[model samples]
Target: LTIVCIVGGGPAGFYTAQHLVKTRPDVQVDIYERLPVPFGLVRFGVAPDHPEVKNVMNTFTQTAQHARCSFHGNVSVGKDVTVQELQEAYHAVVLSYGAEGNRTLGVPGEDLAGVHSAKDFVGWYNGLPTNRDLRPDLRCETAVILGQGNVALDVARILLSPVDILKNTDITQPALDTLAESSVRRVLIVGRRGPLQLACTIKELREMVNLPGTRPEMEASDFECIAKMLKVLPRPRKRLTELLLKVAVETPEETELERRNSAKRAWGFRFFRSPVEILPSDDLTRAAGIRLAVNRLEGEGEDVWAVTTGEVEDVECGLVISSIGYKSLPIDPAVPFDPRKHIIPNTMGRVQKCAGLYCSGWVKRGPTGVIATTMNDSFDTARTLLHDMDEGTLDISTVKPGSAGVTTILEKRGVKPVLFSDWEKIDSEESKRGEGRGKPREKLLDVGEMLKVAWT
Candidate 1:
């Protein structure tokens, strides 16, 4: 039997495992997750209210329960067992550890109390233990998000969403409480380019437009040349552009009237602005505002780039969330990583010059695309591994020990791997707890608490 070890229990890892198991009857797969829980981003990055996206978790759960598959959670790859160690024990090693690091804006005053990365903020509300203590101060009336991605819109919607609406979701109790007390009423989502260059999709944008008791604030000039180019763009981009134009231009009179009457909450887009620095308060301890350098588009369509106009403007707000993007982290010294691309050096899922080793998802490519894209990428990697095995390029003739060998090594090191059944126990407890609060499930945000519950 060929023993395959996949690092990371995210969508990429699970999808790869699923494809491998379905294709090869003689293959046994073991998934290693650093967290006690499985479903990486689905559990900690997706918005609470967007339960539809989390539906993918049901499919992942099915993969984990496969008879030929095994899940080893709370197992840190680099610390507990190195990549070389796994490669030796298994016939093949696949690195699907999705990007855990967030790209930072290299600007002054970024370390201020009110500034946070969208990754951390999302983790905080979604019950990731690492960010449980991120007690962001939402006492200010205005909040500024420094990107136009779906993540930026998620933050905006969460901040402006009604407390009653959030209470029904599986959002952390602490986060729900803090949001209920949030004084923020206005959110300004700023980007370096115009509406045509927005990173968010139409689904999220439409949700923002229809958010209850909230109004959209857009500058009419932002959509000046948008309509003329709408017919020339692709279907998705054209539809998105048309929506923006309708919101910013077609309904100007109605929107103005709604803005005058609606006093609940408001959000707006500030285009052609790039962050120069996060302004500090009088005492220099917290963020008071942000300094932005105005920008202009240099070209048309998708090739457009932002050019600084040399004019700086300051927008007063106490909170700033940077939703720039995510980057992959170097797994171990044994694995080859391209620091420049922030990905494992791979060609068609095969690690460059490294036989019997592969990578997929964000670690194979940069952080972009939706779930469908990741699933397809992972499937390709699994196919590559299978091709190598069929062609005798990967030698599995030496009868490897598989999970039993790794279990003995882990036992000697005093590491307790959480099994799929063990996670089910934790999952059950979380669901029971959520029942008391009328939500889906209230996650245990501490590792100790999670293990204790699982062990119980």
Candidate 2:
């Protein structure tokens, strides 16, 4: 029997295992995750209000429960075990550990009290154990988010959505309580490019436009030349641009106008502006505002780049969340990592200069695309691995003790691996707790509590 090991229990890992087990009946796959509970971003990164996007978890659950596959949680690969060690126990090792590092704005005052990365901010509300104590002060009147992606929109919607709307979601109790007392009335989503080059999809933009009790405060000038160029763009880009035009340029009908006029909260897009520095509050401890450098597009269409016009603008805001992007961190000194790209250097998911090693998802390519994109990417990697095996590139002739060997190593180190059954126990407890609170699930935001429940 051929044994394969996959690091990380996120979508990439699950999808790769699903393909391998279904395609090759003799292949046994084991997934190792750092967290006691499985489902990394699906459980931690997805916004509470967007539960529909998280339905992918059901598919992941099916993969984990497969007879030929196994899940080992609470096992930190680089720490509890090394990449080189897993290679010895399994015929092949696939690294699907999704990006966990966040890119910084690289500006002054970024270290201020009110400045937070969207990765941690999202984690705080989604019940990621590490960020449970991110007690962000929502007492300010305005918040500045530096990015124009779907994540940036998710953050804005969560901040401005009515408490009644969010009460039913899986948002943490602490986040819900803080949001209830929030004084924030406006949010500015700043981007370096024009509307034509927006990174967000139409669905996210539509939600913002239709967000209850909130009105769009877009600048009319931002969409001046956008309409004339819409017909020549791709269908998706054209549709997205049309929506932006409707929100920023076109006048709404009477009923819609009334809704806009009566909105209690507001959000706007600040296009062609790049963050230069985070302005500090008096006493110089916390973020008071942000200084933005005005930018102009250098090229036409979606291939445009932002060039600073040397004009500066300052907006007063209490909180700043940078949704720039997520980067993958190096797992171990043994693996090859491209620090500049923040990804494992690989071709077609095959790790460069390393035999029997592969990678997929964000760690293979830079962090981009949606869940569907990740699915296709992971399947490609699985196909490549199978191709290598059939072509005699991967030696599966020798009998290797997969999890049994890893278990022995882990036992000596005193690290208890949480098996799939153990995770179900924790899952059951979280669901039972959520039932009391009228949510789908109230996650255990403490590793110790998760392990206690898992082992119980």
Candidate 3:
């Protein structure tokens, strides 16, 4: 029987496996994941509080349990195993490894101790093994968060969420303690433009504004800015406009101020300014303040917001969280990646030049949509693959399951592949350890912990 070796265990990988095995019962499928456990970003990327969104994992697990499917954990391309070997051994190789990196907000003071990327912060709270100890040092009077996306909103809500309310969740050790001692009294959410243009869903914004510690408040000028934009903003095809209208009509100025004040009383923010540069707080420190680029509404009426010019000013903030956005990472040399788009170059699901290679999910398309979108993408790829199989055009070389030759080749090449059992033990240990802490499972962050949990 032909063995289809799938790489990654996220929504795309397992979905594809589910499709491939269901269609062709005679075929054998092996899913290889770099993590000791499965479910890539879903296990670590989505916010922990939204347990409903994470229910996708249940379906993924069910798919993995198919008789024709097997899982091999802790194996990676380039370091743990070579892409060329899988090409030679398996009938087909599918790369569903979603974007593994976050887009950096390349700004000054970004490398400082108190600054954190939203990606790291989200992972720390969501139990990504690589960020179990990741914590935001919130022991500051003021905190500034840049960007206005859903992820940005997530960071904002999490920063303001009650520490006691989060005790039962699978929060990282450092994050838990930091929240318990968080000295952050005021949080400033800065945007380059007004809130109308903020790239966040209304639901996410509400989650932030209505968090337990504080309802978020808006400055009168901030509301004015939003109201003014609403009167003249164009109706675009994007859903953002729909949400904009909903906010403008449903929430007027009187209630807006009340809600804003409520949020302010709870957790306040300063809006409508841009950050020019981050300045140091003292004469002898890395950075203790931010040099804000002041702005003014330039155009009058329709033209009023058309131009904005600013003088420079400095603002003091103890910590900064850059919540820019998420980017789909380009595939490494191990896979055929489109550098310009950061996607795996493929025709349908098939890799363009490489025979017997396929791609699905974010690597194939750009990063987008909910978990359901990923599943549909995988199902499409699987259909294309099945077509090739029926025509006998799929040329798979002879290879045995867990064979001696394969093991020798991996060892000789210094590729330490993580097998299925390793992941089970890692899973067991994490769950068992979590019982004492009254959490779901304690994550293993960083490369060292991952190795110890999976291999040692």
Misplaced by over 4 Å in model 2 are: none
Segments of candidate 3 deviating more than 4 angstroms: 132-135, 220-274, 283-286, 292-313, 328-334, 397-406, 413-422, 445-456
Write down the lDDT that model 1 would get. Answer: 0.93
lDDT string for model 3 (172-211, tens) is 6667777778877667777766545566665676676456
Candidate 2 lDDT over 3-29, as tens digits, reads: 999999998999999999999998999
For model 1, the stretches where C-alpha displacement exceeds 4 angstroms are 252-260
What ranking of all candidate models by lDDT puts the best one first? 2, 1, 3
Question: What does the lDDT come to for candidate 2?
Answer: 0.94
lDDT at 262 for candidate 2? 96
Q: Which ten residues in a row have the lowest lDDT in candidate 1?
A: 251-260
TM-score, one value per model: 0.98, 0.99, 0.83
Q: What TM value does model 3 have?
A: 0.83
Q: Local error of candidate 2 at 18, Å?
A: 0.2
